[model samples]
Target chain A: MSSDILNQLKDVVLEFDIENAEAVAKKAVEAGVSPLKAAAALTGAIREVGDKFGKGEFFLPDLVCAAEVLKKALPVINSAIEKNGEKANKSLGKVIIGTVYGDVHSIGKGMVATLLYVAGFEVIDLGINVKGEDFLNAIKENNPDILAMSALLTTTAAEQKNVVEGLKKEGIRDNVKVIVGGSPINQEFADSIGADGYGATAPEGVKIAKKLLGIS
Target chain B: MQKGFKRKFEPIKILSSSQIEQIHSASLQVLEEVGFRYDSDKALKLLQSNGCAVDYETKIAKIPPDLIEESIIKTPSSFMVRSRDPEKSIRLGGNTLYFMNSAGARYCDVDTGIVTMPTLEQNNEGVIVSDALDTVNVFPSYTPYFEIKGVPPVMSCPVSCAQRMRFSTKPSRGAQPTDTFIWETQMAQAVDAQLMGCVEGAAPLSLAEDACNAAFYYLDAGFPIYIASGSIMGGSHPITVAGASVSHNAELLAIVVLLQCIRPGCGIIANNFVSAMNMATGDLNFGTVAVALHQMAYNQIWHSLYKIPINNTGSAFSNSKKIDYQTAAEKLPLAMCSALSGANLIVLHGGVTGELAYNPILAVIDDDVASTIGRIVEGFDINDATLDIDTIKEVGSTGTFLSTKQTRTLWKTEDYMPRVFDKTSYQEWLAGGQKTVIEKAKERMIDILANHKPRPLADEQDREINKILSEATKYYKKKGLI
Candidate 1:
């Protein structure tokens, strides 16, 4: 019976049925299946989705929708696990991300946030036109493991350096790793700005985030 | 005012006749059953009055097959776009092929590949270089850069249009992201020019109010319309090429029905900018074989079946960050496919990094590519002036024809001499510093900038453009968009 419920959870994610994911998660909980087992099933299914994406069998929208299904189902499973007096392994790490000041471009930052969430990271997106003070405040409040900044315009790209400088001035530079990315950014820019890493694309950004957190 | 290439031979067709009918029937069925949403109340009313089943609340318009067929017949097969200089006017239909300048949001340095927000001076320089290139017959909407430094986002379109009018006399297209088409029309009228008004559709069967409004305003001003529905496969559209063709066709046809109903016999050119999605990276796979196939199929359908003028944007960009061999390899196949398959206007020069950057040096190199493709589509005359028999008898097998009258008179016309390609001997190349194509392109760009000057606007026309720009600034400010 537990196996049936777990399979149902996995099938829902694989099929990208966001509407039924939470209901299926609730069903698995009521069936007395371990929330950990159900969560593992979802992770496995999303990994399969990733594999299909890599193989070109599935596409970006399919990957995104499947990740959304996982996102919708995980909260229900985590809440049930908490009710059972258990800790849920819900996140690889916490990441705070945003597009820097004076740049209203959000597509790159938004894609990185979604990919990180799908990769088992808890992402808190600060949204576009984010100021350095807001980054500092969010870091102080959320105490995230990594900070990611995106600046699509060359004029606003300097804001990445300013944010890094602000972190140093606030004396929290050593607490969190910094990752920068965008069209105008490269390894040289990242190294000059004292950033920990640079990602040329969104998938690369997620991989760098994992490496910075010492996770797989 | 360049005489664009004409395809003397029959165009290449990819889809069978039955397959073309299947896609067309599928689009008609989708239009009737699935329906499309028009956000404008005026469009819904107009569509409903024209026998479409429109739900005002949902804004869905289900057009019938007959209405679509009748509209297709009503659309003009060809039309003329007038330029400031009458010599630069172009006809966008039939076998005539024209190349338009591609657009990007930022300017890339020729040597460094660093992209930055373009200043107004840099934008003018891009337009000047485009004007100097004979292969660039028309200018696309948002020509060199989408956004210029020190210009308000709300005013970028009008500002870009005004700059294009000032720098080049070529016919330009107008965009309406922030209601800039109103000012664009006025600026065009100020210079006695015409702007190809753009009416773009949102993907997955929807038309926004801004686009609908632009169509009405442009038609009222006696200008032709360019309709496009840019979609990504596996995202807003189906993944299969045929399925994407059906969906893209239905989206553009919805606008076609709307336009023909409003003004019968109006000129319209449907544009195909559909791109395949990179599933692994979740980015657009620009200049891919899938996109080229889609364009080839689209060109055949639009040209042979629908008898409509079509524009292909599949070669407008590349996924590569810099101008390299990857950029050329990725861009050329789609361009050649589009040309051979009968695209009326192709957006080809200066775009890089998938619409993120532009470089004038790249445009200079693309001129050679465009000329070569144009020469191929132009084909050659078979009826010989002398049958070459008399000339062959005059010069025996051992005699040299290099110095013959036939060679001297027809040498320049017989073959295309590329402006930037190196044709020197190996030792000569080594002696001349072994300059690569990029270096040669840079040198050519510098020469054009220094020597080639586009026709300047008259004082009265210049003052009128400035006055219209000032009025647009105030208008956007009043609307809180500036």
Candidate 2:
């Protein structure tokens, strides 16, 4: 019965059904199933969705939907695992992603967040038009392993450097790795701003996240 | 007042008539079978009520060919765009051609080649330069590369529009009609000059909410809407130029149909900013021969069949991050093809790479190119005055006509003089400083900025425009946008 609940949970994620995925996750928890193992299966399912996306068989909306389902399912499983005196270590790492202030472009940041989540990272998406203070607060609260920022406009591209400088001023620069990206961003800009890495695309963003976390 | 040139000769056809037809039919099929998504509820409902099959959950609409055909018939082939000064206004069909500069270029890195946002003063200076160029029919909204000291982006539009109106009397091209400021800017423009609303169509056959709102607003306002559809090949479209053209046309036509539905006979200019994708870097390459081919194809097809004015980024919009050899090579062909393809309006002043940055010096250089292409497209006349058969006879074999009456009378009209081109011989050119084209362009830029005086807006009109801008800022601040 527990195995059946787990399989149902994974299927819900694969089908990108958010409500069902959450409900099935709760069912697996009620059935005394291993939450971490179920999460692993869901992660595997999300990875399959990413593979389909990379292969051009699926569009951005499809990948986004699948990620949303997995995102909804994760909390339910995490709470149940917490009740059992166990930690949810199924995540490869934690990341905080947002578009810098003065820029409201959301596509690039959302793409990176989705890809990173699919690559087994716990992503805290801060959305668009985020200020420098917000990045510092998110880093302080979440203590994430990576901080990814995107700026689509040249006007706001400088804010990426501002966020890094803010981190330095707060003495938290070494606590998290910084990744800057967007259509206007390049390696020179990234290095100028002292970013740890730069990703030109969503897939490349995932690779950068994994590399930063020392994951193969 | 310098009005732009008109093409008296035939446009070069890169694609045969049948190929254009096949592409059109294929696009209609794609619309009917594999409909694109529309992010606007208003558009979806409007299309559905108008005989389209719409899936509400996915917001996808499959439009029938009959509806598109019916809508196309209502669209006028030509219209006039008025300016504050009637003399500066332009007609938008036939062989008439116009040139305009770029708007909202955040950076001006001409000296150090280091990208940095421009200040409002620098932006104003750029406007002065654009006003001085005889080739640019209309000025563009001049925005600082960075945010102004106290103004938010949402409110920057009205300020920029007001500033441009104050400094230059030429009609200005509207910036990003997708923004809410476009509404505010239009409101400010209503009191004075006319603006051609710039609306971009989302690729892969979709129309997002902002784009839809912008299109509807301009069409409703009775202003000419410049509908630009940018399709990055292999990203949101097919890899091949022909296939990308098909997708680009579909996207443009879908919006055209919607515009016609909103208001039949509304003025619109079709623009396709198609480019290829660099697979290795995952970057959309704007400066490429393939992109030039796509621009030419779209220009020819739209002009030949639709019988309306077409806008193209033919002379500008490159992928080189810096102004270098690659930038020149890529921009030249695209601009030449655009002029030859009979594009009615081509954007001549723009960025070096991917429209991410702007350099006014490039505009000066491109102005020279526009002058040259203008002469080429004019095609030499066989009329007696131009043919000068009598003059040829008078001069004969080795005799000189250097002092002839014809030479003295028609010299200005007969020869195309470029402002930035080096006419001096090699030794004299070196003695004059051996300046590169960029350096010569800079000298002209400095001269224009220093001496050219744009016709100023009336004092009362200036006060009224500033009041409108202040109101817009207050409204946005109330909404907490600032």
Candidate 3:
């Protein structure tokens, strides 16, 4: 039984299957497998992916795929811990992430994603070409600790406000902290966009996320 | 301060959108009726297809305004001007401002200090790569200011430039091969084997009658040619500030129209510098206030006319000392005005002194200042949130605003904190180094040079560079460059 649980944790770490990570996780839970060990295994793998990104050994598609793979494994890994009465009911924190509309670029968002992961926060990325409604939904759904968005194009920076206004229309204003980022973006634009925080670089983004979450 | 701004300068006009439109219309009129002369036949063909009247006799093309505007929109507002030698490249039109030094030719000032007609060591070969890499904002071969070290050729040839770098012994001899159209029969290849390209400064040469014969050369061994035009008002331009700006604008406009006549999307920089030639001595004086105004006007007009991102030469001082009122006045206004005018670059900062006589230094303060100055130019956007009137009233204007969330948000993002000028009490100043900005800058220089590890070059490339610098060493030994 012990070996079976370990094997399931390993498979999840390997990202061998979409449903299998969750299914095997459930099986491990039934067998009374340790939740922390399971989490440690996946976190270790994800950390490797993150490091590889930092080292330039991996590209954007690899990052997106890895993020997706991690996404698949997270719930399963969490559910197993919940079953064992060690549920991560308290998350490190939450983040609402999106690409400002009109900007098809996603690398900045991806950097923020990896940074949030390394810093131990749950980030809900709304993906590229996302409009204000999408942000509203993510904020409403996740009730995240920080709302983050990025736009690479100068023309699309205006869309950042549209997202903020969208949040207002939905009556969820001021409930979540918004942090804005991108290449052309400055503190001025971020403030103008009504975001709570502005980070110039990816590392700074992590710092902002942690600070916003009251996580020091 | 904002209201008093007009009192000082009569409020230099910020051209309204309509005024911009008028300028564009005027430029188009110049292109179509006044006509631009071209050196290359291919450039002429490109212009003719795009609604330009091509006159083979003068190698000139007159383009319509709408067409030029259409072509301008296609030009990449942002681009990475790659360095073949330097491992890093700087992005033009990116929010980041790149820097280069004040590299125009040095002639005897006659008044303050004699410029002593600078030679190869003091000019192009000695200046190129180190000058490009020492600061930032990618510098093109200041065509005339090509090298500080020895290189074989500075002709309109790519192989020649590369060959020179490969043969030089200097630590920083390199070139990013750019396409330039020579006579109708020959063209310099692009640095990359795969891409055909051109830089903007070569416009004047490419838009001439000689370019016709070079056509077959480009067609066969063709590399993309980019042309750029530069005008230094006092040195080679009109004496009046506005007059100088107008001359440069006319030159740039003429050149681009010529290049567009040849190749529609040819990259260019509305690159121009307005330097004050000490009226008495004729030395390049950067601190003169008129040059700042000239640069500001030139940058704004170019942006308004082209809509293409511009790379303007900004702030530089001719003094050997890195910090002074000359440095302060010249560097500050040049940087600020360029930023306000949205210049993609301001090249001479950090370790640049004697009008760029010194390149390497131990201090990084200049670099720090340059970086801070760039961020300062980005400026603040004031809206309801920035005003935070409610927050202000609740906290009370007289009370401390430091503890507010807005303050916290702003303080974190503040790009500059002026430190060289001591603002502390006299006692505090005594406690620290009782030094002025120049002494502080010198100390900072020591710190940077002591800490930096120059980006390394490939062994083969290094060998080529060494061999070339050795030749320069010999040349200098004969001529005493060091």
Candidate 4:
């Protein structure tokens, strides 16, 4: 790719250039770049930002800015991809997520939701301490994909099972994939309670979701 | 080196302003409106027949002193709580002391406070830190369920004990009174009766009176009972130091009274902290106020009255990294207070975040520090050997005391001998990778877990211990608590 196209593509991911994505797309076209190559360039930029943030070279503020830049850049990139109709990461399906009952903590569930959004999946965040029936109601209403449950406190971790059991009670156990995460929980606990998958943190949850989704 | 006696007795510490009131209120409430739940139908019937208001729906019963007096009278005074290991028996009464770790630290800091991750590494580090402290007799904190659940959940409590228990035998090592696999230690304790408390159905002081009563019931069973009263500064009691302290002491005292009543002079542990929550939010400080307010004052008062031992959230409860300034700032005072106040058992040496967590080498560092702290409290005799005035007077005119016999005799003992500290020069330190104390501590942990062979259990003893735990676990399984 030409320098101008590369710069625009880099800005798309680093600066969350979704708003500028159309201009970046035009630049890519001007440089005779295929949508596939331009998309690869965007993914590569995100990876670099993630690496820098992980290494402390970039911090949370940097991450927010970068994500915003990507947000701004996505439409232009998406239009180009749409025009070309190149097959990239489509939806890894949809995920309905929330913290279990009697728990107001949101960080654990929030992280998982953010990661899901970033990893090219649709996420519906249901807020905190959702009752057992609520999860089932959402799943039935949305008819999306996976059901992700989170609980940071030990007292609340038990509620994850209640949600899963609620699904069973509602006669929709096998209809959706199930996953659990939190501070006090472990994989064995998830298994014992019959959860389909477990993750220690949000990023890990995304990875687990991918595995659960059979997303290669 | 001569193993001399180190006396740590805190006598001046009395209840803080809030502590006095919280207990008074809690007691009045207990006696009046908010009665207790009695699981046993027989116990319930006894209470109901004796003018107690029984709520069958809630399984709660409130009784008068007249009805409780008989049951209270039947409870023994001066029961021994035995350690699973025959060698770990301890007598609980009068000036006797036992220590335990500070527990359930808050997750996030309010202002400049930083939140932390609860990991296995942090938990083990806490045990190591406690063993490293000088005055601490016991180290109890995090649920090392990770290691215990897999490796030897059977030895979960035991391994936690072993983390710091193997240190100098001068102080008896005590473990948490967990329901899981702890009966092994209790059975083994039949020999000496040294182990301590169990969860009183959720709250710290929940079963203090009953536990002490039960242990005393089995007094003839050959175990000393230490009635330990625990209070969560912000959660269970109050957020302020004064309020938390009062609640903690009052509850501990009530339980202590029961122990004393059961066995005239029984062991009592008063556990408290000045844990304050940023009320606008729910954030709480676990350590800063713990040492400054609660432990310091507690050890002083308890020592003066009954030679009582004190349990506290020590340096391990700090909200900082490793043995940095924060750890020293939070821990040193608590240790000194224990030493000076004569607290028989000062727990949570290298512990962190109010003993809800730990750092491994910190354990060794704490142990090394307590040696110095122990010495500070011990003071010294102006004897001929210690004074060395003649030698000093002669050498004063010249130079070094290196050649002197007095120096040769005492120098080694004078310093705080570190189990995992590097005292080498900068150049040598560089040669050794210029590691801080934490690095050395981590190394020690790996060595201990890998090289050390924990003392094993005997056949009959182990069998009986397992039987007890299995029986208890069965009850829990039935209740779905496990």
Candidate 5:
């Protein structure tokens, strides 16, 4: 019976049935399935969706929808795991993301955040027009493994360098890997600003993030 | 005037006759029931006199359907805009198609991708480049950059008009933002040229006072008016294309009624610049399928149904920052769709980064795109001699037609040779350093800048333009805007 519920949970995520993801997760918990097992099913389902996206069988909206379903199911599983006095499921890493200061552009940053979450990274989005001080504060509070910055305007792209300098001044630059992206950003700008990497697009950013942490 | 491309075939129709009538009726209902706000007292008085139900306090003019149809009929089907050089004047209706230079706020570097405020010299170069391109027939208002170095905001329009007049003989459009049209009128008169007066509308069925005043001024000057009301889908307009089309059509028709009432038989080109909102980012999504459908539907209703000239500004820019595959992928489809469906003038060339910047190199590359679209719409001839059955039989079986006189005489007219796009073999491309289209565009831009010289203004006309610009500078300085 537990296997059945777990399989149902996986099916909901794979089907991108975001409406029923929470209910299925609850049923798995009530069926006495381990929260770890439920979480594993969701993660496996999302991985398959990601693989389908890679193979061009699924599109961007499908990937985003599947990730949204995983997002809905994971909280119930994680809370249950907490009640059982167990650690939550493993993540690739935690990433702090936002559009840099003076730039309110959000699609590229939002896409990066969604893709990172689908790649199994726990993401804390700071939203748009984020200042260097705010990024620094989020870094200190979250202690995330990565800091990703996005700026769409050439006028505002300088703020990415400011955030990097703020990290260096706080003496925590080594604590997290930094990846910068946006329309105005390129590899040369990333190198000049001492960034760990630059993504020409959102999918490439995911690959660079994984490589920076030496993850497969 | 240059003979623009003619669509030998019927325009592509996206809406059934009943659907077109449905949209038209809905638009009339919105105009009659919801009523469009005309902020100017003169406009209100004029509408009230023309049998439109007007509320002076609310500034809403509820136009009746008969009056709307009558006003649309009063507008001329086509009109000529005179340029300093007679050869550059362009007709703005019928089956003919023309290209206009797009506008941007800043200038982008071709190699480094850095954007900055354009200098006056760079702005002049942009105009000259547009003037030299074969496909660009008209200069849109604020043709290269909106802001140039050392020019205050209020004076930018007049200065840009002066630069366009001095550098290029093409017919230019006029803009109104704080009495600049007054000076633009004087400058155009100084050169014996005509300006396509721009009277734009604010979205959600409203016309601001400045735009209304510009209409009065341009009408008094006897220049044709270009009307546009650019809106965002799901924000300022309805989310669905069908719903948005009703609102967009209603907004434009309101202006048409006002212009026709102000001056009957005036030339007008209704522009459809509506764009979709990127729901995720809250920015304008240009060159999307939604925008293309909107333009196509707008073209059908205005061109085939109302018999009015139309312009499409949806192809002007892209969300992509650089001249990459994304830029082309975004721009070309909407442009082609506009050409196939009935557009008299298309706003294309140089616009990039969602109207944030313009690059002359990008304009050089877009020249190729514009020419290709022009050639496609100007469909091939289908006559007996051109069919060349005799030549085909003469070169029967294993023989080639490469040496035929028909092939030699007709290949140039039959095919479009792009100015910047590469169509070389792999070995030839490698031998030539495999330069991409952007590199080829850079070389072309340099060549034009070095070789191309636009018709110079006569000494008296140059002095007259200088005198008018000085008067504008002094007028704005007294207003503390300079």
Candidate 6:
């Protein structure tokens, strides 16, 4: 029963079946299958799907749905593991990301956040029009390894610099590595804003996040 | 038949009646609930006086459904743009489709297909080639202004308008949706041609004051106005195609209402240039399957319901910076969809990479593409003569009729013959040095430039157009725009 339920959890992730993933996770807990074991199984499936996506077999929508399945199943399994007084596992890293103020663009932010989460980071997405104070608060609350900000408009790009200045004001500038990106962002702009790194794309964002956290 | 003969053909419809109504109803809801703002004081006061609920502080105008409906009804279904030569005039609306060469590129490089600021001579060569292309029916309102020397980049609009007026007798449009372009339209009209200009709407239901004033200027000048929306999804509009389309529709309807209010029964053309923003780059993405579907759906919705002619930037926009396979791949689907869906004025005959670059070779290739699409849109007639029952009976038992009278008479109109695309045998092709479509297009372009001469503007008309140019330059110089 343990092996069967564990394999079923992997199947749920591979099939991108969020509802089935949640149901199977609950059933795994009820049947006395270790939630840690179920989570490991699901993570394996996610890695395989991510690899396939890297090989171009899957598209953006496929990766998004697969990530969603894992997301839905995680809570059920995490609670079960907590009930057993055992931790699931350590994540690769934690990230706080948002679109800067005056820009209501969410797709790029959502994309990087999803990819980072899929790569095993604990991501706290602040969503669109996030102010500098919100970034500072999230930095204080989450103690994130990296803080990423995106702004599509040239006008809103100044907000990225504002957030960096806010971090400096709180004396937390060195606590977290800051990464800036968007359509108009470049390495020069990133350096000018005192960002530790800049990502031109979502996948590149993931690599930068992992590198900043010293995660393989 | 004349070379580059313009004709009418039925457009293909891809949406259901219920779906059309769904979009319409959704659009109307946007207009009433989430109104777009107009930045123009003149436009807002006009709308407020016409019983619209106007918030002067925000400049938002929530137009009633009846007002939008009435304006749509008042817009002319079709209008003829007469050229200096009566023989070259064409109607824009109904089943008619006119392919115009792309305008507004800062560069015109063909050899390497790399974009750079072109010289005036290169730009003039482009205009002359466009005049010679059979598929290109009319000159667009704007062309690449910076490419031409002597005309300050700021004065390109007024300067290029005069250049096009002299280059071709084909009726053209203006590039600006502002009062500055209004003067050019006025000049074109004075030179015995009516120039149409577009007035763009700020998406999410707003029309700015400048665009509104531009529309009014053209209308007041007794010229037609193309109500355009350049809404980029996920940026200026909602992320979803349908949502963005709703915003576009609302903005267009609101502008139409303002036009009707300002001058009842003014000539207005429906134009949607809505494109999605690429999430990866945050750039305006014009070459995507989603964009093609959006254009097709827009044509279907507007043409079917409003009975207004549709104009879309078809096959003219691409993200590919060069004229290569990617450009071809991106262009064919868009041109095909726009053609099949039956957009009335399909612009961008030879545009590449978001239309920041123009090449005459690409233009010639696009002419071939437009011709093929025009033929496809000109779906064959199915009456007895085309059905050829008698001919089929006479040619029974697999008899050949290559030399028959019917074959000879129908061959010209029955099949589309591409001028630049080759259909030669492998041996003949190899023996002829293996020319590619681009190579052949380049050769054709050279031939046209060397030999083809556009009908010259009358001497008196030339003087008047020059006088208009000098006056415009002086006026713009005083304004410090040049």
Model 3: per-residue lDDT, tens digit, B226-314? 33444454566667775555445555666555545454555444555557677677666664577777776666666555655565554
Instruction: State the weakest 10-residue window (summed lDDT) of model 2 chain B.
Output: B140-149
lDDT over C-alpha atoms for residue B172 of model 1:
93
DockQ leader: 3
Residue-pair clashes per prediction, in order, are 1, 1, 60, 70, 0, 3
Selected candidate, larger DockQ, 3 vs 4: 3
| Best lDDT among the predictions, by candidate number | 5
lDDT of 1 at B236: 98
Native contacts, share recovered per candidate: 0.00, 0.00, 0.00, 0.00, 0.00, 0.00
Task: Residues B320-345, candidate 6: write the lDDT tens digits.
Answer: 77778888887788877887786887
TM-score of chain B of each: 0.98, 0.93, 0.64, 0.69, 0.99, 0.94
Candidate 1's C-alpha lDDT?
Answer: 0.89
lDDT tens string, model 5, B134-247?
888898878799999998888889989999998898999999778888999889988998999999999999999889999999989999999999899999999999999999
Candidate 3: list runs displaced more than 4 Å.
A1-216, B1-13, B40-51, B54-58, B82-89, B94-96, B101-137, B140-227, B232-247, B261-267, B275-290, B317-323, B350-365, B380-412, B418-433, B460-482
Cα-based TM-score, every candidate? 0.69, 0.66, 0.49, 0.51, 0.69, 0.66
Give the range of the ten consecutive residues with the poorest summed lDDT in model 1 chain B: B398-407
List the candidate 1 regions with Cα displacement exceeding 4 Å: A1-216
- True lDDT of residue B50, candidate 1: 91
Residue-level lDDT tens digits of model 1 in B1-482? 55899888889989999999999999999999989999899989999999999998899999999999999999888999999999999999999999989989999876677899999999999999999998999898787998899999888888889899999989999997878889999999999988898999999999999999998999888899999999999999999998999999999999999988778889999999999999999899998988999999999999999999999999999988888988899899999999999999999999988989998888999999999999999988766753577778876854435424465445566679799988754434665799998999899999999999889999999999999989999998899887
Model 2 iRMSD vs. native: 30.1
- Each candidate: RMSD: 30.0, 33.2, 17.3, 26.5, 24.4, 25.9
Off by over 4 Å in 6: A1-216, B1-11, B144-147, B393-395
State the displacement of the C-alpha of residue B29, model 6, in Å, after optimal TM-score superposition: 2.1
Off by over 4 Å in 5: A1-216
Residue B135 displacement in candidate 6 (angstroms): 2.0
What is candidate 6's lDDT per residue for A36-89, written digit by digit as tens? Answer: 888899888988888887786765656677787888898998998888899878
